[model samples]
Structures are given as structure tokens and as C-alpha cells.
Target: MDTPILRNNFKSEEYQINMGPQHPATHGVLRLLLTIDGEIIKKVEPDLGYIHRSIEKMCERDSYQQIVHLTDRMDYLSSHINNEAVCLTVENALQLEVPERVKVIRTIIAELTRIASHTLWWGVMGMDVGALTTYFYGFRDRELINDIFEETCGARLTMNYNIPGGLMFDIHPNFVNRTKEFIAHFKTKLPEYDLLLSGNIIFQKRMQGIGILSKEDAISYGASGPVGRASGYSCDVRIHHPYSNYDNVKFNEILKTEGDTLARYQVRILEMWESLSIIEQLIDNIPEGDFFAKTNVVIKLPAGEYYQKVETARGELGVYINSTGTKNPYRMKFRSPGFSNLSLLNHIAVGGKIGDLVATMATLDLVIPDIDR
Candidate 1:
């Protein structure tokens, strides 16, 4: 289906409005220029880098382990995945072997992070569309996940828990039991989310036909995760590339043909359930072994480059490190998926109503820090 898009807005010369750089809807420090006629958006141009700190460039001056803290700030919601990505890449550099138990533990933590992140997005999206009470439900549920994380890693948001060989520590003895209990309650709570927000008639009317990105457009713009899945593209790195025993599991790649904000919401909702299923299977079968690989505290790299891709809350994040047999890296580059996902904003929101623009942006879940970095 052809999406509603701006046509000759420049020739028509519509009124322009600045949507953000200060608004709550931009997530963090995002600016959207909206060209409007009455309430409909004639065009939207996103201005970023308000939060850029040259994090990738800073990595070259620090040791390999020091870079983990920098990744924590990129997508503050999914810190575990970021830490895992950096550790996996460095491990690949040294050709280290990880134990089965370590792999299972890492997988469990990643899923917990996904649930917390999605819960936040769900409530925030509902609020953006005018339902404020749903936000409380999301945060309440997220607190549980946060508690779990805090007990495991000693930090809630910016955990640099993964080392090059293994994890920061073994999963707590109480961790598995607590996880199972949480999963049961979470399963009960999922239906309440659908009743509260997903099936709301007003939300459907607002989201159904707005901000559509066709499959080809999504692929051409390099969208990933829920955005691409909403457009019928199966582009999940966890499924396609199979990192950290994702290959040994059975799961579906959620996709939709509608390519609108609703499609994105549904994709995320279904993914939460899939993540739960993955965790349940692995928690009981966690093998008994070392948490980390054996390596010296002071790390050095050979004369080569190491690249790693890990699925984050947003999309595929890549860490590329080049070393010339030195303690410090020669070059470091971070490929952030939110940057390209946010780039698609102008194309998708140009012809939509002003109210829909907020909903559309929320569905995309733009992490401005990730984009700027």
C-alpha cells in the first residue's frame, strides 16, 4: 500500500513548527522540524547531535575494557546488550572460549533487559497517544526487572557486566527462582496491557493508517528491529546471525505487512512473549562452569581489527576496533541502529497529522543519545 506522504510541500510553502530539542516526546534531546497545514505535517526534518560526546573516538585512547562504560550510555535502557557486544568483540579478538553455562547466563540477562525496555516503550507510547495511566503500569512492571538487574550486576541502567572471556559473575542462586516467579506474573500481566492500550478504539483510529513505511523503503533506509519488522522485513541479527546460542533455540521472527505504528506496537508485544519463552528454557538448564574466560587484567591486542554485532533494544549495534599490536586501539567505530531508524522520520511523518507524528515517533522509539553518539 502507498503511504500518505508530503507532495511538493516546498512549492506549497506551508507553515513550519519546531517540535523538539526540549519536548518530552523526542525521548532525549531530539529536534523535529514540522511543516504544517492546519494540523497535518507537511514535512519533518530531525536535527540530532545535541548529545554527541565523540564516544567512539574516545575509545581509542582507552584500553579495551574501558570502552564498556562508554557503551552503557548509548542506549541507557539496554546496557547489558551493549556490554555483551563489546565483550564479545574483544573475545573474538583474542579467540577465547566461553563455557555453556556462561552463554546461558548471558542470554537470560539480555532477555530481562529486553522486557524492561519494551515495558517502558509500551507505556510511553500509550501516553504519547493520550493515555497517561498506562505509563504507571509500565513503570511498575519495569521496577521488578530493574530490581532483578540491580541484584545481578550491582547497577540498574549502565552495567558493564560482560568481560572478554565470560560474565562479571555467576547468576545469583536466588536468580532462577525469582525469574520464574516474575515470568509467571508477567504472563498474567500481558493481557492487561492489551485491554488497556492495544485494543483501545481511539489508539487504533489514530495509528492504523498513519506513518506507514513500505517494506522496500524500510530496507533502503537501513531500518532494523521493530521498525523493519513492522514493515515486513525479517532483519533481526539474533535470528539471522545467531549470536550467543540464539541458533540453538526455536523462535519466530515477528513481521507485519501494515508498516504503520500499530504494526510496530504488535511486533514489540509479541517479542516480549518470545523473550520470556527463551528465558524459561535456559534458566533451569544452566550448566555448572566458570563465569568468565581466563585472561590477564591488563589486555593487549594483535595487529588486526575485531568487529562484533549484537541485538540491542533498538536494533543491531556494531563495535569495530582496530589495533596494531598495541595496548591502545588504533581506531574505533560504533554503528548505532537508532541513527538510521531516526533518519526515516522525515519520510514517514511528512503527510501525517501533528498528533500522529508523536505516536509515530514513539513507535520508532528514537534514542537520541544513540543517534548522536
Candidate 2:
């Protein structure tokens, strides 16, 4: 009987896996090298540069006007906002004050871009978490916004509407009406989005308490947009810096303290509402004046360093320019929000499941070109 004693020993070893360079959940050509112990994530390392085009270097060779269009390719979802950032930078370097009309118009269009971006994110996020119906609903509304942009700017996704001193052109005759129509339509549909996905028990179970990032960590990792806001970081460029008539509008910078997947998702959902409020405030009050400030055909900046930051759909997009009194920038660099938000992936994603990683990444709402730039 004493000789019948036995023991059982089993050990679990960590293994490595690649989530994507082609995976749909990643949303682009982003490869995440993951270390896993069965269902648990031990580490997440993002392998970027697959889609890098060295846009900053390209800016050195191109005129400032040419550089505006290049930004359209960076964060295509926030193309108009990206254009505005560079335009503001150049205008500031020249000490140019654009017309009041241009300011209100730019603000309205930018908010529309924000809503369009958030709507797309909501749908894609729902799809990522197994709700396919949200994708159709999301795009259906986005199409209306796209139509407005096309009528005004002649393009939808990569709209190079903003130039150095002002808009490339005046707003279309139907721009105001069409934008109002989108606001009216979306106001009703947004509630439906909540009923469909935001309030779902299953979604709450998956999102709540998952991939928790603290306020300190969020700031440390340079998180911004909804990612930083979810962690209670008050880093909204619009609120803090107040460029492009944002100072005139009254809207809340959406924030949450949970710092989990659900908190991030809710912050963006609320932000769409705030975008609506901002557009409403400026749509009718747009002052009558020239669409652009007068500028020379060959724009040149004073020999100095200039920087401008704008609140894009993803977050703060800072355009830094070094000028030697030339048509082209001596050196140009962009501090894209996606790059900073992406940096926090390894920080927040460790210790969650693979499914949790997908949900967390979706909430981050990354546009790979923004990061790779």
C-alpha cells in the first residue's frame, strides 16, 4: 500500500503566434507578434512599416501645397482634418488670418469627417465582435456623408480640400443642405446603433473590464483621441488649443475613467453626438467672406520652425515644419495620433485573451497608414 503512491505533473509552455499582416481583425497590414500561454496573452509586439511610404521625407521635396494632398493618404478617414493641420501650420508661419467664413466652414466639414469616421469605426468594431449587421448600418449612413464630401470637394475618402491659406474651393451650393440632412438622418440612426450594439448584453460582457489601461499608462504611452479619453486623459487638442473656430463652439470632450474596451467604445459613441453639436452651432452662423486668405503663387515660410496641431478623428495630428525661406520645407514631420495610440497596444493588450485583443484593437480604431507614415 505504501508503494502505491503516485504523482502527476503537467507544465504549460508559452508559444508564439502572428495575428496579422493579412488578418481582417487587424484592419490593415499590421502584424502583431503575440506570446501566448494557451488562451492568455503574455505579450503583444506590433510589427509596423509594412505600408510605410516615408511621407515625411517626401514632404521635403514637395511644395507646401503639394504636401497637403500627401496627408490625405496618411489617415484617409480624417483626410480633411489632416489637410487642415498642414494648412494651419503654413498659415501660422506666414502670420495669415483666414476669413471668418472659412473658419466656420472648415469647422463644420471637420466635424462631419469626425462623425463619418466614428460611424465607420462603430460598424467595423461590431463586426469584429461578431455582429455583421452593424457593418451595413454603419456604411449606409457613411454613404450620405461621402456624398456630401464628393459634391463639395469632388472626392470622398482622400479629399484634398484644404490648401495652405484656406479651402481649395468654396463650399458647394448644396453643401449646407446636404450636411444638415445627414445630421437629421444620423440623429435618428445613432439611437438605433445603441439599441443594436452598444446596449447588447453580449457586447457588454466582452468589453467591460477587458484590456484595462490606466490614466497614467495612457499618458505615458502618448495615447490620444478616444483611447486616451477612455482613460480620463484630458488631451483633446480642440479643447486645449482651440484652433479653426473650435474656440467658438461649445461641445464636451468625451471622457471615461474605466480605461477598458467598453469605455473606449462609449467615448467615441458620445463623441459622435458632440460632433453633431459642433456642426449645428456653426452651420447656420457661417459668416460671409472670402473662402481663402490672399497668398502668393509661390508660398514661402519665414526662416524658422513652425508647428500646428489639430484634433483629427483619431486624435491630435501635429504638423511640424522647418523652413529656410523656401517653397518647400527644409524638414517636415508629422506626429500622428495613430502612432501614439498604437504604441499602447503592447501595454494594454498583455494579459488578455486573443478575442480580447481583437476587441481592444478595434476600440483603438487604428488607421495603419497613419501609424506607418
Candidate 3:
């Protein structure tokens, strides 16, 4: 066959397009400046700070107890875990040992937060890839967890349950039973998630070998949670640090050798099961004692720097506090997982297609507020 050439000369140059700041696929107010050659992406530069609220700076002015609420806005999905990280940091600095009951409660809530977060991610990830039904299913499971949080902590998304010493209050009476029921209900539904999305032939092909991020690059970029674990990086804070009651619980850290989008997706799916198992271990034998440890009205940390890390739904959330013997911190910084994970976006997305870039971003689960903070 003879090929007919175009009469007009077309200058071949990569065209730049903006993906967000308002696009829904972005999942937040994140703007991605993408340079594309047709459908293939050549570069991805994330323009953040759209939702920046000066959270770190706000912590400097707020009291240690008040500072906990500011973290709620950072990774709102993992707000409970975010609050715990700050509480743990202050507790560690003051050398205050939280009661056994508080530790167990914190652990349970943290796992619930993880599961809630993953469910939402799974739903949105599917929708981002053109699978719409998965969104409803993901939210269906997530709402149950939200109900549990609402009853227990009185807030769904930004539950400021954790305090400097322990929890704000004891767990609700329905907390244990509701969690068990949700777990049992979700177990059957969880398999449906795999059947609907994970097992789809088209999805597998779209994700399996695309946006490949190697283990070394994952470590270098400081990718954590499912993102790092998908690349076979053993960066699980629970397994390594064992904060709160994580040391007592037995659950496998889900790891996948393949560093593709499919591997990242699979890691989070498997992690939901592991999170359920973790909750099951601690749900029954919650120690009977004070839910919060005794602390003074005004908590003043000694002049020193203190750091504490906890595994949120996204990854390792490290809270660093520099106190100058005052109720308010002299300086504060959060090592947010989303920000670190997002740093590797351009690296993995350079040679992939626009659709592949979407899949990769879905798996990365880059929460914008966390990044901007």
C-alpha cells in the first residue's frame, strides 16, 4: 500500500495541557501541567498550594491540644491517625505513657481509619479508570465505617479523637459490635471488589506493566504505605516502629514485587483485608481502664525537639515538634506521605500515556491538602 502524505507541513512539538485545579479526576484541587506528544506524556509538573492553609504555621501559634485539630485538615481521610501522630509526639516529649486501654482504642480507630481511607481510594481509583460502579460500592463500604466514627467520635471525616495523653473520651458502647458487624459484612463485599475491578481484563492490561516505579526509586522518593510496599519496599511503620498496640497485633504487611500500577492497586486491596484482621485482633480484648491518661491543663514541653511517626492510610506521617519550654511549639513540621509519594509522579509518568498517567496517579492517591500543607 502506498502512503499518501499530507500537503501541509506540521511542526512536531509536544503540547502542554493543564489537568486540574478544577478537574474531578485530580481528586482534589491539584493542577498537573502535562506535556504530551499525542496521548503519551513527556512530563508531569504538579502545581500545588491551591488548598494550602498554613497548617504547620498554625501549629506554632496553637497549643499542643489545639494543634491536633489542624492536622485534621491535612490528610482528612486519615484524620484520626494524623491526630494520633501529633498526640504521640507530645506524649513522647512529656514522657507520658498512655494507658493500655487508650493504646488499644487508638490502634482500633487507626485501623478503621485505614480501611475507610482505602475504600474511598479504591472507589475513586476505579472511577478515574472509567469503572463507575466501583465508586458506589467503595462508598457503600466506607459509609459504614464513617457511621462508626460518627457515633464514637462525633465527627466523620475530621474526627479529633486523639489528645496529648490519650483519647478525648472512651469508645462508644456500639463501637465494638458495629466494627465486628462491619467487618463481617465487608468480608463478603471485599471479594466482590476484586471480581468487579481487579479481575477485569481491561483494567489488568491498563495497569499491569504501566507506570513502573522500581524499588530503589521508591525508597529514594520516600514513597510509603501501599505506594512503597507495592514496589517491595518494606517501609511499613507498624512493622518497623510498632507504635501504640501495633506490637501486640498480628497482621501481615502486604507487599508486591511488581512496581506497576496494578501492583499498587493490588497492595491496597490486600491491605483492606489485613486492616480488618488487625481490628479483629484488638477489638475483643480492649483493656478496661481509663481511656485517657492524666495530664495538666496546660501542657508545656521541655526545650527540645521531638519526633513521632505513625502509619496513616497514605503512609508514614511524621510529626516533628520543637518546643522551647512553652505550651505552644517553637516550630512544627509534618512529613506527610502524600507529598513524598507525589514527588515520584513525574519520574514514573514521563514515558506513559495520559490514561496510564491517570491510573498511576489514582494508585499514588496523592491527597492534595497533605501535599500543600
TM-score of each: 0.95, 0.97, 0.97
What is the per-residue lDDT of model 1 for residues 1-373, given as tens digits with 9 covering 90 to 100? 3334444433555688888899988878898888798887878888777899999888888887888888899888888898889888888888888888878888899999999999999989888888998899999889888888888888888888887788878777788888888899899999999999888898788789888999999999999999999999989999889888787778888889899999999999999999999888887888887888788787888789889898888888988989997877899888888988988988998877888888899999888888887
Q: What is the lDDT of residue 90 in candidate 3?
A: 93
Whole-structure CA lDDT of model 1: 0.87
lDDT against true structure, model 3: 0.93
Q: How much is the lDDT of residue 124 in candidate 3?
A: 98
Locate the minimum summed-lDDT window of 10 residues in model 1: 1-10
lDDT (10s digit) by residue, model 2, range 1-373: 3443432233578999999999999999999999999999999999998999999999999998899999999999999999999999999999999999988999999999999999999999999999999999999999999999999999999999999889889999898899889889999999999999999998899899998999999988989888999999999999999998999899998889999999999999999999999999989888888999989989999999999999999998999999999899999999999999999888888888999999999999999999998
Q: What lDDT score is found at residue 299 in candidate 1?
A: 84
| Candidate 2 Cα misplacement greater than 4 A, ranges | 1-10
- Candidate 2 C-alpha error for residue 107, in Å: 0.4
lDDT of each: 0.87, 0.93, 0.93
- The C-alpha local distance difference test score for the whole of candidate 2 amounts to 0.93
Per-residue alpha-carbon lDDT of model 3 for 29-64, expressed as tens digits?
Answer: 999999999888999999988999999999999999
Best of the two (1, 3) by lDDT:
3
